[model samples]
Target chain A: MSPKDLEDRLVLAIKRAETQLPDDVVSALEKAHEIEEGSAKVQIEAILLNIKVSRETGAPMCQDTGIQTFFIEAGADFPYLGKLENIITDAVKRASSEVPLRPNTVNPFTGKNPGNNVGRYVPYITWDIVKGEECTIHLMPKGGGSENMCALNMMSPGRGIKGLKRIVVDHIVSCEGKPCPPTVVGVGVGGGADLSLKLGKRSLLRDVGIRHPEPHIAELEEELLELINESGVGPMGVGGKTTALDVHIEYAHRHPASFPIGIAVQCWADRRATVKITKDGRVEVI
Target chain B: MATVKLNTPFDKKDIQNLKVGDTVYITGKMFTARDECHLKMLELHKEGKDIPFKPGDMALFHCGPVVQKKDGEWRIVSAGPTTSIRMEIFEDEFLKTFETRMIIGKGGMADRTLAALEEVGAVYVHYTGGAGALAAKAIKKVTDVYWLDELGVPEAAWILDVEEFGPLTVTMDAHGNSLYVDLRKEIEKNLEKIHAKIENS
Candidate 1:
């Protein structure tokens, strides 16, 4: 395929991600709106309305457009292997200036320069090699409110199942309204620090109300959801019955001595969009 | 008159008179500053340079907006409020120096901010955080901008003429009652009941 064709596909893909709200995120917001009651109900209604206005008006759902991170699945035979990285970086810079996305990136140590993609591991592009002729990209704009609530705990293996539940639920309860509930609770279990954290964030990509394929993990998801909602963290941390819209868990093998669990909470605005590029250079935005 | 008239050190009686859902059309010169701008404003005040726009009788919005230039001027694209808790640390001293009476932001702050509001005769208004474009439309004109060269658009405060600018909700009144504090307490109580069940189970 010609480089022009490839660049055109890339640009369209970025714009499509910007303009469209992903089905999963929209459905999650709708479900969150339906289940909420009382003042929480009002909050959700307003939130939904705000989202509608944002969509119709072509403004970002939140002022903090957040760090533009991409998770990519690419085929080994992908036409533009070396160029995709620069294409993605260029897309981010263009989006930051054009989409008028907030320049959220700030330097850590110096406390100066707004490089515009400056979080710890920001504009984070996670890549996976797949056996296919197509390249797919998932765009997730992770905001600061929910990102602030992310944490990890070193639990004893002896504490086992019950201890794990307590740690997850307790942290959600403590955060209350700060993370901007109702939230999707992503729990990472049995991995080392970095892996566990990735697992936690990866869990958020799951569809709302969808349970894990594994019965055991699914059960844990349910129990945690029930426990978290019971906390009354409610919509925007107001008084109500439902604090969490859903709970997702992902796990990995770890050292026998270590039981590292990471929690990444996402706010009600959970914005995500995806796009696929064909070998022929046609772009499909999902 | 080109300017809107407002007074400083607003009293409880004045605050009580103000409703939660009141439309405010502000004209008197107000500073547009958020996190970084506020820090610089403080430094300017410390050095005894004439601070931009007197804080008394002026409004400050906790916003970092999307701005663009047209015909040799900058304009707001989406200038909605940001979460105010991040500013909770600087509010006490800032309010005193700025002598502010109205703070517009989303969500709410802690008791300390409420106390500071009471002392400063200021009220906290909750703007819809995500409705940036809608909010930006209300601002009629960009009169001036401060700290533009060094700090970039998000940090610099843009002075503007705002008309019917707000249907802002008052989350904290000057008398010291805060909706967020009460709401959080209620949520905590309900949380305990849920934990009790989990423990018993």
Candidate 2:
């Protein structure tokens, strides 16, 4: 209800996201570890061990604690909407020092770090409004290595879904080990260039293995996942059976002439956490 | 398949003996160097100025760590490898100029780095990506730090002492062998088939 209460809850949510892998992601990785062999198996084992150490010590899972990003779904009637931005920013500052997030934000021109993880438009927030009495916040701390692998393609509308599949497959293959496979591939189709990329990144917020409601879109996700894994860019790209843990696709209606495809890749760590807050000040973090 | 244990100030023979896929654990001293640290080190080399530490005596890690100062000591909270390919442009000269024998990072480096490894009798090992906690556990102490003010924490060169610090896999070797190169070729071949499957479907 109050700004301090909300900020404190956000800080704890960030700490959870940093130190613990979500249940879905952890289970998917466990499955990969069981199925892989040879060098790929070894890499997965190290990753599992790392996950254990991170959870136990409450240390960040990755050194690149990532640029802080929050996806907020707020009820139009939620009383604290006006103060949400400031509260979220303050939470980031506290989490940067307390959870000890890497100071990832830097001035593009001056190359100076304020060292608090707050800078021009950082702790980037994406907001959605709906009719409800609760605000739900999702934190996805995206690492730099995989973030660098994001790609966008503008294709002729005539190219169709086949062309989309080709472009996505080609991009992931070219990325090789750079994005840190076993990665989660998020593909955004049909939107304008910027919207496509945004949708692609937002699609990563979905839990691994959950399919889209539409049958056709769900099928596309399965096909893309199969093709990517078949590429043999396995765990950390050393070669294995599982190149990607999952593939997620989100789409929007396109203009007559242009089809833009955006690819957002997330590494194996795939750190994300969700918090739900009610108008009465009750908070729950997952 | 074999596991090798290496200490700092590695002998050329120890580096030369490694091949792709061999797991390695390292001990002794190392320095964290990321984009700015690499650039600054190269610039210092060009100016013929003294470097803060001896490159040949320590392993170079491509890392930007989360650190905290507690009780008057710098502590590594999470220290994992950054993607190595970003440093591809500087690595060849870095290896030749400093004769650094080992590189620890995630992802992989390019041909120039592989060639430099062959020429310099060095190897590039991969610490698992996102395994920062595991890495910090192996680091025994922060010996010193350089360029803290100029480059900030992640970009600063933090000198560290570590013990048996790795499940690092030798991905690039002094004999001009690279596991990444091999994987890329295989993936490319598979991509063609995947494209065909997409076309037919």
Candidate 3:
């Protein structure tokens, strides 16, 4: 496939992710709207209206527009293995202007903005190689308010499952409305600090309604979901029945001495989109 | 549940009249400033140099907006309220320096900001978070922008002309009362009780 075509395709995908709340996110908001009352309900109305206007106008769902991050799954023998990074970066820079994304990337020490949203280590990409001829890319625009609530806990091996529950609940309690509830929480267990946080954020990429496939993990997700909602932090943290829309967990092997848990969070917008490219050079955005 | 309209450069009477949970629709001038802008303002204050714009009855919004330049003119595409807690340390000094009467942001602020509200006769309004488009709808014009080169788009101080911009709730009032503090206390108290019950069970 030509570089321009791939770059244009990625740009389109980023714009979609920025403006539209996927069906699953919208459906969840609808359900929450129906059951919510008082100030919580009022907040939801504003959110729903914001979504409607943003979608219709192709404006961003939120002002932050978040830092753009991509997860790529490329076939082991995929062509253009070397060019994928440049293609994504070029598309991101284009999107920053064409889609008018808020140029959020900054030089941490110097506080410099390149203005095109591309900087050192920006448009962060996570990659995986698989046995296939097609490459898939997922774009998630994560707002900073929610991202700041992310936490990693390295507990003694003795804490076990019960300790995990305690830490997760405490984290939510402390977060309160700061992260913009009803958030979708992603919990990663057992990995080292960085991996755990990455896994936690990766969990947010899952389909909204899907729980962990394992029985034990799924049960924990369900229980954590209920417990978070019951905290009464509600919509936008004012107070409501939906403090959290869902909780997902992903794990990796860890050192026997450390029981690390990471919590990654997404605000109600939870904007994301996926695009798949075939070796035949066709690009399909899902 | 009460609805009220306020113009910029609020009088003491206007600010003192508000209470927690009061719905406020603000019009006239409200400037957008965030962490970086606040720091710059404070630096100017230290240097004893006059900052741009008029003060008094002024309201500042904690936001970093998605702004684009078209034909050399800036337009606001999104301007949602950002979390205010991050600015708690700087807010008191800012309120004092800018003579700001109100602060509009997403999450509520901490003790320092609440104290600033009490001392400075200002209020903190919690604009519904994530309603960037609706907020942009109320903006009549991007009157001016400053520090674009220094702080970038989101952090730059974008002076705006907004009208009837609202769905803002007065979570902190000038009368030494804060709904956020009260609610947080209640939640923490409830949490302890729940924890105790769990332990007993």
Best by lDDT: 2
Q: Which residues of candidate 1, in runs, are more than 4 Å off?
A: A1-19, A31-42, A111-122, B1-14, B18-31, B163-167
Candidate 3, RMSD to the unseen true structure: 2.1
State each model's TM-score restricted to chain B. Answer: 0.85, 0.97, 0.94
DockQ of 3: 0.60
**Chain B TM for prediction 3:** 0.94
- Interface Cα RMSD of candidate 3: 1.7
Leading candidate by DockQ: 2
Question: Which pairs in model 3 have colliding backbones?
Answer: A234-A240, B9-B57, B10-B57
**CAPRI-style class, candidate 1:** acceptable
C-alpha RMSD values across all candidates? 4.3, 1.4, 2.1
Which candidate achieves the best TM-score against the true structure?
Answer: 2
Which stretch of 10 consecutive residues in model 3 chain A shows the poorest summed lDDT? A223-232
Tens digit of per-residue lDDT, candidate 3, span A104-221: 8879998777878889888899999999788999999888889999999998879677678778977987898888888899999987989899999999999788978899889889
Higher-DockQ candidate of 1 and 2: 2
Better of 1 and 3 by lDDT: 3
Native contacts retained per candidate? 0.34, 0.86, 0.60
Ranking by TM-score: 2, 3, 1
Interface RMSD of each: 2.9, 0.9, 1.7
**DockQ of candidate model 1:** 0.36
